[model samples]
Target: MRIAVGEDDVLLREGVTRVLLGAGLDVVASTGDATKLLAMTLAFRPDVVVVDVRMPPHHGDDGLRTAIEVRKRLPATGVVLLTQYCEPEFAIDLIGDRPQGVGYLLKERVGDVDDFAAAVKRVAHGGSALDPEVVTRMLRPRTVPSELADLTDRERSVLACMAEGLSNRGIARALLISEAAVEKHVTATFRKLGLAQLTDGHRRVQAVLRYLAAQGP
Candidate 1:
């Protein structure tokens, strides 16, 4: 997939770019300037854009603001907003008005090349990939949703893994269960969450959204 990276840290940016290149993804552009990042994305229209949560010209939420703008202006271009901090609220902002083709992951996730590649592919192909840590924060300090109460604990676990963008096989490995069992749990979780309206794959993204709503501020 073609990707553009926006990170203020030079070492991290170069390292990430090299890693992505080694992984065979096209790195169309890399920049630390927040506005330049936005401009490059608009111009190149890469398949995916990876942005740090903080960046030049403010460093508070410039990267985030750019990611949100990309979603609004270029909805088809996938965006992955990376953060060193676990801020579920920022993730919520990305998913607030529209969740399609968007991802929110922790910067540390980049250390795992396999996971990083998976996240890039998932988002580029129009899937949501929220960090598990972010989802955990979202779930804490919030009352469980009525719909979620219908899910068994195992099913809830399955759904949480789903929010992390894990495939059935991945979830199976994580939970030390058979892939078939994971599939069953996924279906049951979808049904219990009243997410039957979504198609097979879409149900996964919608499931994350449901979880978000259940734990949203």
Candidate 2:
């Protein structure tokens, strides 16, 4: 898969490029500037972009903003935003209403080369990859009543793993349950969320986002 990287830290940028390249993915462009990153993305139209949440010229949420713009202008290109810390607000803005072809991960995650590569590939192929920590943090603050309140604790745990973009098999591994059990929980969760009609991937995204949106902020 073709990839582009945008990070202000020189060492980290090179490290990310090396990691993706070593993973057998094509590296079409790398840049430290958010604007240039967008320009390069437009020029190359890479399959996925690994962008730091902060970059040159602003060093704030420039990369996150650029990722959003890329989604708007190049809907086919996937984007993964990396942050030094867990930033739930940025993730919310990045995912918006449509969470497909997007990811939000901590910078430390890049050290896990295999998983990081898999995340990029997952997003490139129209799947999501939210960091487990990000998902946990997002879920911890909910006290309001919503559709999520209708789910059982086990179902909630399964949905949390789903929010991390894990497949049923992956969720089974994480939750130490059988794949059949995961399937049952997923089905029940979908039914309770009124998402039984959408396709699998679409419903999962909608389910997670609906819960998050109801939780507020």
Candidate 3:
């Protein structure tokens, strides 16, 4: 995958670039300037952009504004916003109505090379990678939809893993359950959530949207 990076912290920027390069992804451009990052994104149209939540020009949500703009102009290009803090609101804003090709990760996650690289690739390929911590915070203070209230505990856990962009096998591994069981829970979740007619990918994204909606303000 081809990726562009934007971060004001030089060390972190270089580290991320290095990590992407080491993962064998093409680092088409790397910049500390938020404006330059947008310019590069328009110019190169990299498969994905790894951007800090705060950057130059205003140093407060400039990166996020650019990310939202990128999504508007280049919906196919994936965006992953990196932050030092657990800010669920930013994730909600970035996702908006369309949740595909998007990710919101904590900066510390960068240290986990394998997982971070997988997340970037996942988003680039039209999946999502919401930070689990962010999702936890989003779920902490809100109630889910009435439909979701009927989900069994196992079904709810399966839905949570799905929000993390895990495949059925991956979910199975994470939850220590059989893949068949995961599939059954997924089907039940979809039925209960009134998402039985959507395509597989769309069903997953819609289910994720409903799950995240529990955190909406």
Candidate 4:
């Protein structure tokens, strides 16, 4: 797959490029500036773009802005955002318009080449890839809706697993329950949490984010 990178750190840009190249993916362009990165993406039309959270000229959200721009300008291009810190607000914003072909991963997690490569591929194939840490922070105990508060402890566990990006089968394996049971719990949890009306995957992510945000820091 063709990919572009936008990271202010020289070493990190090189490391990520090397990893992608080693995985037999083409690194079309790599840049430390968000503006140039956007330009490169428009010109190259890569399959995916991996970006850092911070970049030059307003480092805080430059990379993030570029990601959003990609969503608008190059709807077909996937985006993978790597951040040194987990910012739920940024994650929520980046995921606002589309959850498919989107990912938010912790920079520290890049040490695992296999996982990093998998995340890239997942986003490229129109799937979500959120850092486990991001999910944990987003799902911590909070004053959930009264309806959600009614879930049994086991059901809550199922919901938590879903927030952590686990598939029904993965949740089943992790909780030592049958996949069928996991699906049942998920359906029940959704109904109780009033998330049953949300059918879009992106909206579902936002629903979970809103629930978590209401629960507080």
lDDT of each residue in 1-217, candidate 2, tens digit only: 9999999889989999999999999999999999999999999999999998767674556788799999999999999987786867678778888889999989876577999999999999999999999998777865645668898767887888987889998886665456787999999999999999999889989989986776677
Model 3, residue 32: what's the lDDT? 92
Candidate 3, superposed: residue stretches over 4 Å from native: 143-217
Clashes of 2: 0
Prediction-by-prediction clash tally = 0, 0, 0, 0
**Cα deviation of 174 in candidate 2 (Å)?**
34
lDDT of 1 by residue, 165-190 (tens): 89998886665456777989998998
User: Each model's TM-score?
Assistant: 0.64, 0.65, 0.65, 0.65
Worst 10 residues of 1 by lDDT: 172-181
Predicted structure with the largest lDDT when compared to the true one = 3
Which digits, one per residue and each the tens of the lDDT, describe model 4 over residues 1-217?
Answer: 9999999999989999999999889999999999999999999999999998778765556788899899888988999999886866567777886788999999877688988998998899999899988888777875555545788666776767777888888886666456777888877767776778888575458546755664567
Least lDDT summed over 10 consecutive residues: which range in candidate 2?
A: 172-181
- Which candidate, 1 or 4, would have the higher TM-score against the true structure? 4
- Native-vs-model 2 lDDT? 0.86
Pull out the clashing pairs in model 1. none
The digit string of per-residue lDDT tens for model 3 on 108-176 reads: 765689899999999999999988999998788755567579897678889999999999988866654
